[model samples]
Target: MPTQPSLTLAQDLCARLCHDLVGPLGTMAGALDLLDDDAEAAALAREAAASLRARLQVWRAACGAGTGPMTAPEMAALLEGVLGGGRVTADVTALPPGETFAPDVAQLLLVAALLGGEALPRGGVVRLAPAEGGVAVLPAGRVLAWPAALADALAGQEVEGPRQVLAPVLVRLAQAAGWAVSLSAEALTLRPM
Candidate 1:
């Protein structure tokens, strides 16, 4: 069986989720507030709600029990959800329809995208490509902030100290997928054994 994160790490994940959700949640609330006065606001509220729903679906696919053999369109929607109306963009245009990945693999790619977003504080483009055995993530932007410790963990190295809050979970997911994670200044790749 794949390794599961410890309780403390699980709590950290929850905190991260809450952090990411705050903006969209606030958007939904603000949209509703506007609805009381303007008809156009209702449409905006609906859009925000839909965005939230899409993001929730992606979160479920990543962390929930029902990891899907999700279709290309489905995966595209999930990636877009991660964009979250930010300056960052995902180029999933190359993904062919009907192609799917194991849930673990999909989750790792998503998390990698999240990592890329974090690396580019000012926002950038995330490019996706289906490679043999797994996927490739290319982020073009400012300097990447990936810590050396996390890189070692992802490369399947044993580290001594307490793991970074998000490290254990991501490493577990990548390992569960039978993937060897490699990160460079230009891109991150997950290669299956």
Candidate 2:
């Protein structure tokens, strides 16, 4: 089993979340100041608000308290809200339409999506699909480079820092649920143990 996160790691993650929120919050603040004078600013404010909400929702599922069962559409919406506007696009169409994932599995899928996105720095599709043993997170792009730290973490090695936190958390989550996680240049696969 993977070790639990330490208090320091928790603090670092908090800092990371704050850092992620600051940009959208700053945009909203600036837009608010110009809202009275410019119609464009109102549009900007609305966009910023949506972005902020999406980030919060995604983070809640990724790092916050356990969410109950989630359907494929629900997860896809959350992924689209945060990752769609950027270079990466999320594809959950491979997931069954009527099926719901248990809370832990849902969380795993979200984190796996995030991790897959990280590897596609150049832009690509992050796809979630049912695998023979479990689920597969397949990220395809012109170029793919998996972070060494994350790979180490998946291998059950001790890694530090907020950026590297997700990999270990994923390992722990899968372990707790009796699943095995493996990563490759092609995909991240989680299988029943």
* Best candidate according to TM-score: 2
lDDT of 1 by residue, 1-193 (tens): 7443465567666776676677778988998988879889888888878877866776677666646566556666677746524667777666676677666777777766666655665677777777665677777766556546567767666433232444556687877888887777777777887
Task: Go through the candidates in order and give each one's C-alpha lDDT.
Answer: 0.68, 0.81
TM-score of each model, paired residue for residue: 0.77, 0.91
Model 2 gets an lDDT of 0.81
Model 2: which residue pairs collide? none
Compute the lDDT for candidate 1.
0.68
Per-prediction count of colliding residue pairs? Answer: 0, 0
lDDT (10s digit) by residue, model 2, range 1-193: 6645576567667876787789899999999999999999999999999989988988899777757789888888888746634578889889897998888888888888888887888888998898966889998899787767778987778877777777777777787768888887798998788
TM value for model 2: 0.91
